[model samples]
Target: MSPLFPALAARSARPALRFGDQALSHAELATAAGALAARIAGAPRVAVWATPTLGTAVGVVAALLAGVPVVPVNPKTGERELTHIVTDSSPALVLAERGAELPPILAELARLDTDITGSTEVAEATDTVDRALPAEPSPESPALIVYTSGTTGPPKGVVLPRRAVAATLDALEDAWRWTEDDVLVHALPLFHVHGLILGILGPLRRGGSVRHLGRFSTDGVARELSSGATMLFGVPTMYHRIAEALADDPELAKALTGARLLVSGSAALPVHDHERIGAATGRRVIERYGMTETLMNTSVRADGEPRAGTVGVPLAGVGLRLVDEAGAEITAYDGDTVGEIQVRGPNLFTEYLNRPDATEAAFDDGWFRTGDMAIRDPDGYVRIVGRKATDLIKSGGYKIGAGEIENVLLEHPGVREAAVTGEPDEDLGERIVAWVVPVRADAPPSAEELAAHVAAQLASHKRPRTVRYLQALPRNDMGKIMKRALHD
Candidate 1:
């Protein structure tokens, strides 16, 4: 496939993106990208630290159009994380917002005479002259290198090829029925795959318009939905917060009536939250499954009765299988049997960047081992059990899923958020512990009350032995819970 800028430029006069008060047509966006790309064409890689705005979008697409691999670093990240990403990527150029502090890597780049630009002014160039650059990227050529949340170790860069990105866009377009008329609300952070691939590229591939929200706020998201956004994509936590904020406001609830589709992913959406969102907005939330390594693998249909706990069927061109510990294939129709979830498709990442041994260990034959445990119902819909690495809890000679306990904990009326992990125990080997964020700080439930709450829903061995109150659960930049970090 040709570079994304040229493909988008074909519809130059059409509206491509909308920021706070600025709108850019496809031609204008491409022109701005070309100008920026020209300045950094010789750079091996470019790092960007800006919020999700139209300017950042132009810079990224432009860098790619110029054949420079773009690494999107979160603007809110600390200096240490920023340094690691920039040094590992070895970016020759850095684009940051004016007045934003530069990390040490940028200082090193300056010492090396690399080009680094920072500006608050949005690109105003409307001239349609397209500068010549490498138009065709090889299918295997790395297009973007996104770093994972590093649940196991330090974050490793995940290299995605142009073809893989294109294929994911194609698959999303077909599966989600995205059309040119759809106006998407782009509110998620751009550094993560959910926002970049699902929130941006997925809509743009269908020639849809995107309104980028710099940050997620309940009122801000409500305002965008009220502004006639046809489709919305966000992580589960964002949706849950929005639902909580709008629980008492009927007008705000009415404002969300214009949304045709609401998608939730990145983390599991609690079944209770899903029902609450549907009750408040009168729109069913379609939950999908994906990670940084794969753009999108499966989705619960928008038109169908969305199963509360299932992520539904795999998308077209995506193949999924469940295997036992021995790697033997299991029946997808078994509703109670759980196994490892493996995937294979054109959208899967080629490999983790510079981690050949990890990559070799990641694949079983040709299928990518997702390290996620899942159970498929008789309808072929899959429900994620938990992560294999961090979700196991041992108690009374029995193994339990922390997700199962967390799911039950989230059902409590007083619970706002929940995370479960195993704490060391001499008798049981490992004891189940729950960290809960309560809805009301003044009247938070005690550990005994929470333990009783879980005892009612879970098996005796699966009940949490301890419930700790926390202001918030530890999460990485992508909003995934860091259970190991909590343990530490």
Candidate 2:
């Protein structure tokens, strides 16, 4: 197989990475990553304390170069979550910045401090050490052991093979029309797939350069885009802020309007924000769908219409099918029927590490159960309704998706943020409930007004039976609305 980063060796002084004010040329980053790769070359596995710093990127690239399966641990993880991840993916060494103070949970593991300045202790002997390094890892060899958020139970480690990474990135190349000419920009955390794999490694895979904001700010976005950056990656929260700021900041609107692509993921980007940004800058924010177990399953094509509320067609190699509750596949794409999404492709993870039973149950006839419920339009665009466990609300014998209701509520002038859920009801079996953050706390929209707003947009049956006002909706690090937290 070809190298994941085919251009890393040939680019002489071309910029490859930028964090805040620091930048690295392709040759410089190769030397630094290669120098570190030689140190942990033959280790069983390595854990990276994934901060948004350049060191975290260096450590991850080094591990990939060494063909070592890297476990990227979230730096802000609580004790229990950290312990679970470290214990599950028992790595021989934990990689972190030179002066990083690790938590007590990582005390048992050996540590390796990385120098982003290209001046490691073994810098002098880098050439000699790299000359004798092993060949590229096998396509099927494990590359990453990413853990789930563990919302349901203990977070399971999803083992991703090198083939999965290579296939997904290559597929993205086709879908996004990505090339070395593009300069990617984002401020997503380095710990998750969105930031680490797609945000960082994506640019490297395409031989393009990346400029991480280190921290997300509208000013930083305008600075990079106004200079030379062509693409922006962000979650819903960031784009929402951008939508909010575009009304006041003409520079931000101009910078965004000039960008080649604006992508949003991790959670759904509200149709309201999508329209807001589009009206201000004429740039449609494209959304994609994927998870930790599957790197990427579907995305809106670069050449396709940037439609709101739908995450375009399936990726090149991915085979997608919607399954009913009875395990039957939904064949028709009439654009209204909801079914659970199941996918099969080379982009899928190999297994749930050390969890044989869970892995066995996750697959059915080579297809992995995605647990996400969505509907496909006649044009083949997939619109995710919500998760089956939480987002699918069965009320009055009708299965309602919280996403549709939430989107309608977002369009309401009085509602700033909205989340939909269901509760036990004797009459309807389950009643749809709306949790809303109002634009004006003192004169918030009444439950009847909000319910009417949703009924006018969607069906009356999908309207919320009750509404609860809050200062803000509960969200996770990824900006996903945590409905479970509402009951908790």
Candidate 3:
């Protein structure tokens, strides 16, 4: 396969990236990353303090150019997590923006301050730098070692191969109809796959530009989409904010209406938010399914229907199947029977770094076990309900999906945010519990009322047997509710 960034070396004067007030053209990025790549070349690996800044983008690109695997460290990570990452990855040096304050754990490592501003004297040397860079590494070589959120244990390093990145991006290009003329806009943090790999590298691989909002806000989203951004990428939290603000802000709705594509991922976007946004703006927010181990698997195609609850069909080259608890492949696409989603494709990561046992356990018959429970439509669209471990509730001998209940709960006017989980029950084996943040704390809806509301929408057995109201739901950086924290 060709190099991951062909357009970078093209030296086009077209704008390539924008973060807040800073902007870099394709030529500038190539020069800056190439220069940094020369300095960091031949390192075993490097850690990028992945802040949502121009420097982070350049640093990641530089590491890729030098054929060195890069590990993205979240800036908001606590001391213990940061220490474990540093100790596990054992990067030779840390790449961060100049003068940026780093934590003590990262500060202890050899640091290289990345310069986003390309040297003017290197204007003539852009081509020289490109030529001087190491030959494109083998497609199977490790490109990135991204750490998971470590929900179950200490974060495991997912080693992504160069081909996996290229394959996923190429597949998205086919699915989303993405191209060089498109300019993407988003405000996602750069530490994760959603923000760093897809939000940044996805555009670069297509030779398109991206404008980062630095932080998400209705004002920033409206400004960029209205000005010229063709596409927007965000998680459910950002989209929910847009849905809420559309009624009070006409400009926000109007800006969203003009966009070519609006994509949401990292978590399930509530059907309520989807309907609200579509009703106000005449544009539907597209949701895709992916994780740290798999860069991308399924996406609602740009040319296909933007189904409210479903994640559309698997992308080109991806093989998807549903399996039962006994590990039997569920062959029927009935749209009602739930099963664990298993996928096999080039988009899969090579392995878990230094965890051979864990890596081996993650796959079955060459398929990566996603641990996500979902139902597939006859038409092939996959509707994810929740994680197999947390979202699937067995009540009264009926298996229920928490995501469907959560979506229904969000439709209630009295509810602001909702998460559903199962707890041990003497009668039902596992009783459905609804954790809610109500619209009014003092005058919240009665548990009985909420339960009846759920029963009206879904089956009686799926209704929440117990309701726990809260001021707020605990969410991770990506806006996914930390379901395990609820029990704590």
Candidate 4:
């Protein structure tokens, strides 16, 4: 297999990474990471304390260069979850920035601080180290062990292989028409697949540059895009914020209008936000779909129609199928039948670490079972409705997707944010419920008005049977609604 980053050895002086005020040229990054890679060359595995900093990126790249499996540990992880991840992965050492205080759970492990500025004087030593490094780990070798949110129980470690990473990014290079000329910008956290692998590594693989906003702000996004950044990668929450500010900030609108591409993922982008942004900037925000277990499954192609509600066709080399509850494949793509998304491809993770039973149950034949529920249009676009575990509601013999209802609710002028889930109901087997954060809390939209709004947009059976108000929906760092927290 070819080197993961074929261009790193070019030693160009072009800017490769920029985080806030700190920037590293391609030559500088190669020297720094290569030197560090030599130090930690033969470790069992390494844990990277993933912070939105230059050190985090340097550490991860260094690990990859060393052919060591790197586990990214969220800096905000609570003690219990951190303990679980450390125990499960059993890394030989932790890689972090100097002076970043670690939690007690990680006290036992040795720490290696990553330096983003390795002087060019060390170029010879770095080259010697790279030359002496073992043969590049095979494509099937483990690269990352990312932990899930543990919503169901303990967060399971998703073991992503190098082959999956290379395949997904190369496919994206095809789908996005991405090239080294593009300068990507984002403020997403570095712990997950979306931000860490796609947002960071994708650019590196193409020998492109990335400028990360230390924190997300409309002004920062506008500055980057207006100055030179060609692309933007964000979750739905960031787009929603962009939509909200576009009407008031002319600079923001101008920057967005000038951007070559805007991509959203990690959660569904409400159709209302999509239209709002499009109307202001005349740029359609493309959405992609993926998970911790699968790096990326689908994306709205750069050259194709930017359909607001759909995550475009299965990526190149990926096989996608919808399965019914009876385990039969649903071949009809009439745009209304919801089914569990099952995918088989190089994009899929090798296994859930240390969970053989789960690894076995996660696949049917060869397809990985994605708990996401989605419908397909005749044109091959896929619209995710919700998760089968929480969003698929059976009411009065009709199978309903909560995402459709939530999207409709978001369209209401009075609703600011929305989440839909199912509750046990004796008569309907399950009842649809809407959790809303209103635009005006003092005079919130009445439950009756919201319910009627949803009924008018979708079918009456899909309307929420109950509405609950909140100041804001419970969300994680990635801005995904914590539905399990709603139960509490």
Candidate 5:
């Protein structure tokens, strides 16, 4: 209901953000954003070179303040992906960090560079501070046109409105008991929902502060948590590293134990890593569930148990229900019954920018089809089994989830990382295939040993019929296992 950044206007020298060595107080951010917003006020849309820098944060805030739709382009994007997004979005202007070398891919669009230092610092004493900030934009007006990672096709632009972003942040505020006093820290990339919306805007809306690690490391996490940060946000890769370090690093354990909340998302936090972190720190890592199409639909509540392997109940104001394979709504929560997760609420994206067919297909009635399969427990906690497209394996007429089997394999001391998929088979409809990165590459665990370990923990049918070893599993920037890449 309130403006997304009510904290920026009235400031008293409180620190607002930190990235590597760069820092900005609330007053400084308002001044800088005000200046940038004024320069880009009339543009229909803008593209942000979403680097892990203060300029990126200032540029995004400025665009939002100016009521312009922002298309965040990842800096590490490939040639084809870069060309497609730049062509599709067709922004009136591009905002990037000053003096930073950009691929000639962006040579066409008009560009604006943010000056975060001597040449570009926004000062509270600026003449524009008293200038009337534009009237707040309508809630339904498009705020961001974030493009998906062209997994299925060329990336489709997801049109998220002001209402959706604001509502999701407010719901998280209630769920996490988030407030101005809480200072958050994370090292996630800024292009997506987890980092840009919740990691950045969520705290800004609550009038709190955030410190970005620029790049993630156990040492960086330890330093920030020990300094003043109250919360730490990371993906499973980050946590996996933390879990490994805690076995030898007392400082890392102490820092985690002293923090208020440690959260993981983007992919399922392996139950093994979850238990290890909890056992050492006496604090369980909270998990949440959502997608690019939806900002955040559910999270483990701060007051609730950090249930290992489960993303806790639906976020406030979200209507969540699972549907069976027959397309019937799953009403009662009988444990272990798998279904596709569907959600309806203000937190949903409005459309796939320009693609009416996709917009039409993404929704049934008002609910968005997440394509994610999960089982709901009696108390409303949702444990995601895996994605319907890749992580669900059908073997010998029985449906199987790769997540649980991968978790089982991870429990083995020899396995450092694991991913499971289904491949064509003659006798069985599809056979489970396990791809592993082993701790001991010279003497990797054998198929038989891994099979027996899985069978002891789960049904024998769920064991991988075939095993593959790799030096490392391919992962995206978000730490999600690129299951499709595993095939190649």
Candidate 6:
């Protein structure tokens, strides 16, 4: 088969994209990508640094069509981070938005006489012929190299193959029931896998249109949803912000009524936010599971009853196996037994780019060790506990998963978002502390009231010993709460 875009081009002639009043048919998108591909034929890699926009979408697909690896950098990434990524994955070409300020790496590229252009205006001088570079890239061939968000050490490059991309699109389409008529509201950042694979490529693969917003704003998203977007994807924080916006203006909630599916990923969706959104908008948030390495593994189905805590079953073509610390498989029927979530499937990444030792350590036997702790129910549903490294909190000689306390805290009416962590204490080994962002500023609940909120839902040991109110919790680009920062 031809590359993803060329294959998509033959399947539909309908509008493939809509960004702020700009709409492009499949034919137009193909033509633009083909022309840009011809221009960058000699380049080895292309980097894009803009928020979600039509041009950003076109540029990314164009680079892939041209047989070049696409590197998407976070807009908030500082000069030091950008420089490291650009230098590590040296690119011959760079496509960015007009007047989009360049990171230090781009400035270095300019000094090195590399080709960089404003994605909005494609040069007319380039060749327009659609050249078939290679129909099937090797399964080991690197199609895209994305750097991790680096919650711990320096971000490592994750090299994924064309086959992995194809697997993800196919699995998502089958699981989510994405169709040609569906229109996705693309507001997530392009640098992350949730946006690149799920937000942009996944929809386009099924001949759907993506309504791109340059940046995520509550008002802007409300306006887009009002226009006519059928599917919407966002992190938990973005959904919380929209929920806040709806409180002030009830009309905004009506705009979201048109959406058939509202997805939350990149982080755990707080149970309080999930239930609040359902009551407010009359739609239950579909929380899915994925990461930088694996594009998408599980989703809370739209047609099925969305469980509050579980992330649902594995997608088609994806196999999930829970194993104990000794590398033995754990049965699904086991009662409340938590183990490491392991996966073996086509959707897994080829390897970490240029890091053989790291790649070797990532897998056990043939299954990729996800490093995430989870429990499988009798029905095969998976509820994530937390990462094995940081999930375990020692409080009063008992080890606890922060997710347990966070989930319970989220049930409170006054709490909008919550993150739980272990703090050093002289009396106990470590005390369970809760940091919360209230739904309303002036309506902040007292610590006693919040503690009561937890006491009503959780056991005595699981309840937090201390509570602190904050305006916002620190988060990475992908929307995962930065629990490590809470200690400081």
Candidate 3 — which residues are off by over 4 angstroms?
118-133
RMSD (Cα, Å) of model 2: 1.4
> Which segments of candidate 4 are over 4 A away from where they belong?
117-134
Candidate 5's TM-score: 0.97
- Model 1 pairs whose backbones collide: 12-27
Model 3: which residue pairs collide?
none
Find the candidate with the highest lDDT and give its number.
3
Candidate 5 lDDT over residue span 143-228, tens digit each: 99998977899999999999999989888888888888899999999999999998988778788899999999999999999998
lDDT of 4 by residue, 355-393 (tens): 999999999999899999999999889999999998888
Ranking by TM-score: 2, 3, 5, 4, 1, 6
* Count of residue pairs whose backbone atoms collide, per candidate: 1, 0, 0, 0, 0, 0
Residue 183, model 4: lDDT of: 95
Winner by lDDT between candidate 6 and candidate 4: 4
What RMSD, rounded to one decimal, does every model reach? 3.2, 1.4, 1.6, 1.8, 1.5, 3.2
Clashes of 3: 0
lDDT of 3 at 275: 97
TM-score of predicted structure 2: 0.98
Model 1 compared with the native: what TM-score? 0.90
Q: Candidate 6: list runs displaced more than 4 Å.
A: 6-8, 110-136, 247-250, 332-335, 394-399, 424-429, 438-452, 469-471
1 against 6, candidate with superior TM-score:
1
Write candidate 3's Cα lDDT for 203-317 as tens digits.
Answer: 9999999999998999999999999999999999999999999999999999999999999999999999999999999999998999889889999999999999989999999
Instruction: Please identify which of the two predictions, 1 or 4, would achieve the higher TM-score against the true structure.
Output: 4
lDDT tens readout by residue for model 1, 346-438: 888888777899889989999999988888888788888788777765578775767767888898999989998887899999888889999
Whose lDDT is higher: candidate 1's or candidate 5's?
5
TM values, all candidates: 0.90, 0.98, 0.97, 0.97, 0.97, 0.89
